[model samples]
Target: MHDQPPIPGRRGFIRQVAGTALLGTGLAACTSTASHGDNNDNTGPLRFAHGVASGDPLTDRIILWTRVTPGQDNGGGDIAVRWQLATDAAMRSVVASGTLTTSAHQDYTVKVDAAGLLPGHVYHYQFETGVAKSPVGRTKTLPRMDVRQVKLAVFSCSNYPFGFFNVYADAALQGDLDAALHLGDYIYEYESTGYGAEQGKQLDRVSEPRDVLLRLEDYRRRYAQYRSDPDLQAVHAAMPFIAVWDDHEIADDTWRDGSLDHKTSAYGPFKLRKLAAATAYHEWMPIRTPDPAAIDRIYRSFDFGSIVSLHMLDTRVIGRDQQLMMSSYFDANKQFDEARYRSDLYSPRRQMMGAEQMAWLDRQVEQSTARWQMLGQQVLMARMEYPKAVVLGECSSTAYVAAKRRAALDPASVTDQERRWLASPSLPCYLDSWDGYQSERERLFAIMERHRKNMVVLAGDTHNAWASDLFDANGRQVGVEFATPGVTSPGMEGGQPQRNPDDVAAMMTDMIAPLYYAQTSKRGYLVVTATHEQVRCDFRFVDTVQQHQYTAAVERSLRTLAGPGNRKLEECPPV
Candidate 1:
């Protein structure tokens, strides 16, 4: 198991007093400050070290978050904090105010749901204690009705060690967004030399833990490190966020009970590691939960009035079964084999969102009165099957050969459904996505059809931009999906080495049943603008994540009408 760095002890009384005094004085003297929206108030650090954030907006309320880093005076103990919500940038017209306490037990983080605010109107919020003050954060409540437009800045998979979070900074400065939707991998849990260590070495942005996270403290330290990033802080401070965790928030390729990254032999029980990871997530993120004990209940819905309803899901840790390895179906001769497609792989019991959550989703869809139903979840729901040439090309790689060697030794372990796709132009089910649980995807499709849901899916985890027409196996259109590119993490080109990324993307679009557009080489975030007339999706891309600064350009812009009718995507010229 990985070890955590020791926490510093409390400072001396005199030193603490001096430090606090200097901090307060310096913050007052500073010219670069956070104002209501107009004034430039001193914004650096006085009390809040991680800055202020807001999330999980509703028609009447919004959750505000901040971390109070206490010094020797408080002995890192609980401190009474005051929070205020106002409608003006100057914070003179206060609408709501409250007092709360936060301590090390909850990681000194403060999260207060400011209720009674009008929907679709912008609000400014801040936290204060003694002479210390937090940077004001801007947030907006969800619209209940008469919502003309809502712009969401979508992001995912921000590996700190990989590169700069230029996408986050860009989105923060854009200022036109109503909210931000983070589709997981907000932080990667790997050692300095693991995952993107090579890039980290080049960028001088290494993981602070310096070891792979396993224990509770390890996870906490990792989140602390990620929150320390200025760009991430800026984005959080800029707008309200709706987030869901993918595998990296816990471990790589995480399922309901286990993960590929877990090693019971070295890391002990998988449950404990999962607990630690989930605990840290709850502590650090600004999300609200009905049952704090039920870490799996991250699946929930947000209604944006009569315009749209966003359903966020816990696809990684909720009810997902272990993934089926494709190499298991390959024969010893390195050729595709059809005999291994097992029946259990298609078993109705196998689920992406467990039975309970599935039922909940169905009810949410049925109950929604919104014009558009948006599924916000991790992993691509669109089908991606490989051609025989692509499969052979991928299989011929050294990595695939090694994987095949491992699978051949455990042929009995291969799932039947996976084996079904092992033949000519096999569908190499991306074990981590909806493709791996065909029955569940089908069931979800049926549920949506039953509800007559006019839907569009917003997905991440692919680290690539995609415009796909989602359909049932029988070739009936269900919805259109827009999979956003990464905030910093690599994409398909960065993962598969056998074929050129552009060539592979072209082949995928040409071969896949409903795929319309695929750009797997760029690194950036997405901007989704929603209105009653249409939902506009802008696949924004940056020149590079490797650099400290880069320009953002829209790689593609598409839209779909909002109605009970067809949800097919139509390409629109860039704005």
Candidate 2:
């Protein structure tokens, strides 16, 4: 029998963190500082670090973050920023106070997690530099498990060029989110003129660098360009973000060793591009990634007081193959021969969370004691429909037939689900999702069954809104999925998601009973709140996304209680 790789627990991670410079970049450098041209903030400079922000939202307290740049250089600089959290709107009655030191290393980003406070509490905060102060901000703590109400603004697939982030801007004004979970594809790495799927649309935001990102410089430029968006800036300024990424952060539909658009030979190579994207992500986002040796450590858990536990899944980088199509062929037992399953989907070594990470995740979900355990992820978890006959049998027929034959003869795809397309729902083809990894899907299902816990998956991607009932292998209802529309990214509804929108949501609601709710061509986010008894999701839509504003229209509402893990459309349990 072949021995599987041993799964390392949290302690193993700590050891790995202490022992190696995971990414091969020395630890000294991970925390090192580069010299900036000059020191400009003698008076508390309002502009500290890249910007004032926080992430990893939890029940008791949220992580308060800020960085002070020395000048033009981002690598090195130091300053002190005072942060305070309060319970009232007036900023009186300070609850948490701290002094944070900014250093040249870690890009001068100062992160201090404030803990030990009330659950389900909404707090106002402010950051103070010598004389400059950040705008007053508001955040809501997660509820304890016994608490019966909560709300979350779930979002994903935000591409700046598609349009303005009216979704986020509007989310900020609505003011009822316990926290906003950004499920990834936060930014795209395409050139200024647009590349790949974003190529044809008229761009809404332009980046500083106008090329595909393959090097560290390219990645950094991409992030900086994204940060420069005023609407994006306003969203960040308004509330703390809980975020992760999908393929666009690096390349489209990326797996561990390859991507849909970038072949190993095409962008120099996978390792180089991966490193570049990873480095830039660490330098830019308010999230965390483990050191290279500790690459298995990224999947983490956050307790929203006692009521819910938020699991942020790292599906893109750690281990995942570029998603595959079901159009090809498989064997008698619904298995695609890993060897014969050609294309990026059939590589025997292709992994979604990698073996170790998956095992770790299994443990996290199993050990959770919270009432509602939610996976704040980057893409669709429930199965989506694609008309295999039209997409595979007809649309790209000749080429598809040739590729299918080539993969069948390949030795790597034995038992792969190459032919599952025949059974999958007929719809338009979306090549960048879970439909590509059926085996991985089964493995995850087994884990969920073992735990027998109530699970709700919240996501963004597809740039649309959907509410789905999750099914197990036996087709038994297992969980619920609420996908919030994009903050500003374009949807299948063209650039005008709100246009002729009268029938799309209804059409979707009619087609998929399990997936009973939806809204498209609508810009905005969902406000999610989970309680011991139920999870509430509010689809907040904005009237316009072309400019900066906080105004939002509450287009719809949906809720799912803990009866049998299926979602039911109704008002969320009130806090």
Candidate 3:
């Protein structure tokens, strides 16, 4: 069983702090100077190290979170912390105030639901223990009515060792955002010598613990190390977050039963490790648990008045079955087993979001009266079909690009082999995404088409920016997807180092029917702005993450109109 902290009941507004009501008149930008209490004097035993954050914001309630570090003199026992919510940056016009206790069981992390707040209003919050005070955090409640527009900053795949979180820093400066959506891989479980170790060595941002995270303490330490970064702290302080876990939060390519990265004989039972990871995630993250008994059941929905209904889905840990590997479809004669591959690819038993969650999603969409139904989830949901020759490694991206150019310039210059390769059947490139579970994807599309509602999907985990039109098996467009690039993780450029990244992106867009835009090289996030008429997505890319100082620019802006039979992406000028 998972060890969880006691959840406090929602309390009414208490008496305001004296002599600070005037602070609400003039508000400033939300920024945090707290860095693991490094800049503060060591006078008190308790200190706010990880800074303050708020998440899971509702119209009248929001989850406020912070961690307190106890000094050696203060024995490892429970410590009382006080939190206050106000209508000002200085936290002077205090609205709600409460006290909570934290112990080592929860890694000294405190989470409280600040209730009794006005809807569609920006609020400031802070945590205090003795003389130590956490940096003030700014948060907004979800709009209840009269909603015109809602803007969100979407991000994912932030590998600390890869580089600086310049994307987060840039997004933090955007004061107009309503909230931030983190589509997981929030923290990696790799050891210091694993994955991005070489980059860490060069950038001096190595992973903590120096070993793979298998226990609760390891995950806790890793979360602390990530929270200490100034860029991440600033973003958290700037606005509330709605987050869900992806594979790297526990292990790579994780499914319902096990993960490809884990070995049962060497790592022991995968369940115990998963529990530890989940427990640490709940303790550290600001998200509220829909079911305290079930830590993995994070599929939930948020309503932004009558304008947008955001349904965050758990497509990673809860219901995903083992991914289909291409290696299993090869025969001893070195020929591909097309018959068996097709049979298993369309297996009805294969599940992506599981039956229970799928049913719940159906109910949510059916009941929602909002103009836009947005699905915020992990992994690509669109069909990323590639030529069979490319899937089988018979033709490299460079070779395909060269062949296409030659064929375009002079038809007689194209070889017969090149022609055959170009005419090969198209197949799903990544089996781990919705492409692997075709039946389930069709079921979801059917649900959207049945409802006849405007749909938009926000996706991540590819570490690359993409915009694709979502279509069903019957060739009917159901919705559109806007996938954000990684905050720091490398994309396709990292894999195809020899080929030009522009060529790879151009070839992908040219070949893929649904793909409208593709940025295979860059680290950044996506700003999605939704109005009543249309939803626009601005793909912002940072020039580099290798250094603390960098420049950011909007690479592309795409939008889709609202209404039935209009679910297609069109390029828009960058804002």
Candidate 4:
């Protein structure tokens, strides 16, 4: 499934490079603000309302993006946009320049792959229409030769209604990143009355359209609303972003054929809705389409000289099978069907990346010679199964806490039922994650093991920070996983406000063998620095997302050494 060559002509610069094929395809800040192209005078000039952005950097090329908004008097029509890439912020020395036209068909958004640029160099870019110029955006090309290190700001699950984007603001202010990696859930597909509605009302950040997205226009409006945020705009202006979609981009719990949130009866055909979402995603997002024909095929890889090989995978839309639900395995009287559930859970046919994607990943891993092989993906790859009683709601968190205390105080006082519940067999906490596709996960593990590579997986979507040891079915360490907390989404503490979040985190760390660290109360992001010696992740959290003004601090720092036999995470002193 190699990408075809770059298409010809104006759009020809778009190229897709995964393992070996060059396929022709197609931030934030409180310190910066984006213009929505709203003009009180109907005859005002065109505006770069969405600001400027760049992404998917190769040694010689990078994708630049922006949106053009026309004044009411201008009417709906095609507008020619001019772009320039320069080595200096003042645009004194230009390197690449191009002219492209955008229209309402693409929501007036412009994206161009600026080529013929030098590697490992910082460049400034901007979009222009008449005298209306966009904010200057900063981007860098991937290093083509030996590199000492690469730093990335990792983020996910930024539901607009949830809270302020202080996380993005903090990252943008630092201004010391190679790029930003967004592991899906960049946008939540919920109506005003959905997921973060109450918070949105309090923060005055309610979702636009006021309904769940189903059409192309609906999705575009939502992206516009999110991009309009000052913090989000500042980040994009600061550096490039390598992003992949999780379920929320289209609908909740989206698989290949359908989604849990998409009601065919009310939303029309799921395929149509999915197509609309994909179209909007490509148009609004500064990402190069690997295969323009197959909009869902976003899995690709990036090489930072010989230091790192970053593989961005699509674990959500491209090839996911329908998630298995526990309710399906229950009988009339609520008797559990453990055998049936286990059989389906471990079925070789149940796929996460399907066959083609798995083959692509195998080839990528086998061919890469970089010191670190990193996967920037959505969802946790580590095992997070909990006791069956806890998963089935038979044992509440409070009850479990009490039982543990009682057992510690007097072993003789423990009841048989309490002991049974405490010692119950484990079941996966979220079947929607890799835990549901165990066979596929093992296959991926085998690929890493066979190549004898140093693997580090950066993940999101759980809305909590976690550091875990990745082990295969045979109990051999394959790698380590560092999951970033949500940008603004609530964590485990959101569900259990009565209990102390630290106690919850401690309980989880105790129960899960592979889990080395857990922070289940905060909303934050991860700054991952990969070097020849090790890959360090700094889990930084903001004090509150409930307000625009907040303070951020490093909650934890952990690292995994790079080597054949070392694939576990070790805590580091806070910086």
Candidate 5:
């Protein structure tokens, strides 16, 4: 069934590229901090409260951020903050220095885009106001055009109350990452006591607002509570971050208009609540904005030298239509029919990236000059299927069995029915991912093929590690995908109530054609290395998140060619 729906009307974006260019030129020209006098002194109370961070990196520019409070308490009101970026740690060779005033409107947080630094070079930055100074943060710009390699640390799903952010500290201690990528769920919207009672009590950590986040102040305080974590701060202090929002950043299962957790009936208006979340996110995080008015347009592209182009996407908000619910597919008997079940599933009208962003993505890929293109977005783009045997073995719930049957996956003991159920391949494992929007997934593959771009997709949110081959609808290989495990959020093994997690992952890997690797139980981040030759991804898992002190190991490593014909993938022996 081929369905080609008309593209939706494009929402206008207020591009700030020209204005930012002029500001960058001015910032780059300010090469000394001598004129600032005693402003750089640091022998007083803590004014720079939240420490320092940098993000949204470019070849010649990067954004710097810090929060300033007047007193040691959770203070309010406005204060002047001074920021300086230097080529070295000594603050002797200052490249850019500026002063900005922060008020309660922005929650006393400050963000500055420091430009004119040399590419592929390490730099030091700090924020100061009065006698208070922030901890010095290390940051770097994107590599030059001829650079050889880049190493990135990717993390996601950091639930503060769930456990200690040991994974963040672990990645920071690695000490060799050029930059970090946050694939969303940076802050969950759940209340402290109910969601993570045991861990929160053990860690003595509680979320702000004391309830589920809905108001602007509620979201702001939640971010503040999370930023107060020492381990999270250390990770931010260690390197620049490229971040994008997922469903939890606003609320669970968020789309363009509403969310699962937040409803217009309860939250007053979806737009207001969403704007509050987005506003708080921008205020706390050090991200560059092309236009302040158009906050939802976060689909941007960055170049990591000539080796790779990083395309960051906003899949949860701004674009996605409402997700297809499983309840809608069930029949009167809770039974299944293949043709009727898949009709709505493959609807051409179901949009994922939306119309405008999809067109924008096509242009970005088509005009790219880099050797390899990498998509940093939330949700898995690979095909995952749960075999009938595994389902029957692991799940005993009648409701689950009914749902499977409703999806046309009959597991009757009859030979033909069982055989067909087991042999029917590539069923949707998780509807929350790209599987839910199969037509859009196929459309992206068509775009990649039309542009002749060899791409790699980096995804997180399932809290599991995965390696899969991306294929077009015609079964032609398009690219590869590496999905990182969550930083602290529980995974399939420990989080869910299931039996034989390892067996399920192994079964999927064996039965699924596209999937080469799968680890359902482990919790860790991904270390990605890109070069002219190939891109290598290492899945590093830690021993535990329940404790602050834990050990880590690379569970698996996989690599794919940069410029490819057949696009062969190689898995190395884990050390």
Candidate 6:
């Protein structure tokens, strides 16, 4: 949804080299001896790791991908890359095989769409760059229409700068995922130490970007830095990923109007940086170009037959306003002076999916024939109540007075109660979520109401897992939300206040019953399994994120679709 840059002569070379080196696919020598260097050789010695992967599961076949290492700089010669897909890992019977050429043009990443595969079958796939043998990868096509179960590991917000991808490693070891959905923030936009926190150990690698992303090369390099991460590579090789992005893929808190990272406050003139980020995102990610007709673009539907139909929505770009950086209480201090801090969270025109995406979502939901409709997206859907106890200048007359009871938190967090009662504007200040788009959130809930069908929303990017029973305008139950935590990035309430997961969970439960379960400071992903009767989200957590080796535990949540408006959801200890 952004204008492409004019192809200058030099820019042509940059785009030309995108194939192999840009994506870190083609390597001639080795990632081991060379230590994941920039050796993009087009010919000879093409070696690579992270094996072949497939995604966007269709009935018959899936897309296969791999990166080959060529020699020391050509990004791999114009060598031909061949792939084989067999029902057996050892290639007992050749199911689908093909040969594709790789060059420095594509950064040596070979992605082939293997057809003629039997649906719902496990297939072993492998890639070969000349004489160099690549690793064997396991992939599966989406089940046929009659299948009953689809289990997936859904994740997002993996910052290489944070730590090793232990979460990815864990999921890979789980050895049981139909498809893995990586919901954006696959890479971060920061250099070392630029983003607030740092992992226990130094991040294995730095951004291919030495600085913030402003131009095309900078953005491309950013991906390079992240892809160089071995654990990330392993995960990519391990399974197929259906992905979407949130802000920080470009810059933090971006919208139609500029970004939170901008220094000038005078960028409205050219909109150069914003456009660049969008262009790079399209070129780098496997996502289709934002189709404007679909509303602010990026609202598309994926049919998983009669059981589940996934509508993945793009939250950034389009109609969203520049994110509100501070709460009204916090804003009050800045509103008196800083023009930028003063923002309208309730601005009627600002949107989450924009008018275009909104309308598209409406149609997708209405026409869907699937028994379950899942919206795979970014951001939270249920209304989040911060510690703010004030409404404008007055106090809340509602019975939410008990809501002010702040958690005996890590003693580090400013609870909503502490803020509202203490009038500490900084306590529980949360303007960064869907609360910033009240009107749009309301509109979407209304759509679910009209469809007379049950809905389930899956989300990530928050860095903390949450299970909530969604309610409509009338405060009646409508749907449910399963918000996955981060892969490596830490959440708002990590062990900072250092309370037990269950104790903190109890505080959260006391704060909001609809918000059934939450784990503030854990690292891992969510494994969601859906059947005709119920959609169960297993919020899987790793014991520790700071270490390289960690195990996962799950907090299970369930939602039953009795009818359209009769959806019911609950979070309970895993059975």
Using lDDT, give the best candidate's number.
3
Task: Report the lDDT tens digits of candidate 2 across residue range 255-311.
Answer: 777776685666687878887787667656666444645533456777776667788
User: In order, what lDDT does every prediction score?
Assistant: 0.75, 0.60, 0.83, 0.82, 0.74, 0.63
Candidate 1 per-residue C-alpha lDDT over 347-378 given as tens digits, one digit per residue, 9 for 90 to 100: 78788889999999999999998888898999
Question: Model 6 Cα RMSD, Å?
Answer: 10.4
Q: What lDDT score goes with residue 297 in model 2? A: 41
lDDT tens readout by residue for model 4, 177-239: 999999999998899998888988887888887899999989988898888787888898899
Residues 477-534, candidate 6: write the lDDT tens digits.
8788888878877674532244344554554555454776666666768888888877
Global lDDT of model 6: 0.63
Clashes of each: 13, 53, 0, 14, 0, 31
* Residue 369 of model 3, lDDT score: 91
Q: How does candidate 5 fare on TM-score?
A: 0.86
| Best-to-worst lDDT order | 3, 4, 1, 5, 6, 2
In terms of lDDT, model 5 sits at 0.74
lDDT of 5 at 564: 47
- Badly placed stretches (over 4 Å) of model 3 are 1-44, 401-416, 573-575
TM-score of 2: 0.73
Which is the better candidate, 1 or 4, if ranked by lDDT?
4
What overall lDDT, based on C-alpha atoms, would model 3 receive against the true structure?
A: 0.83
> Could you tell me the lDDT of residue 74 within candidate 5?
30
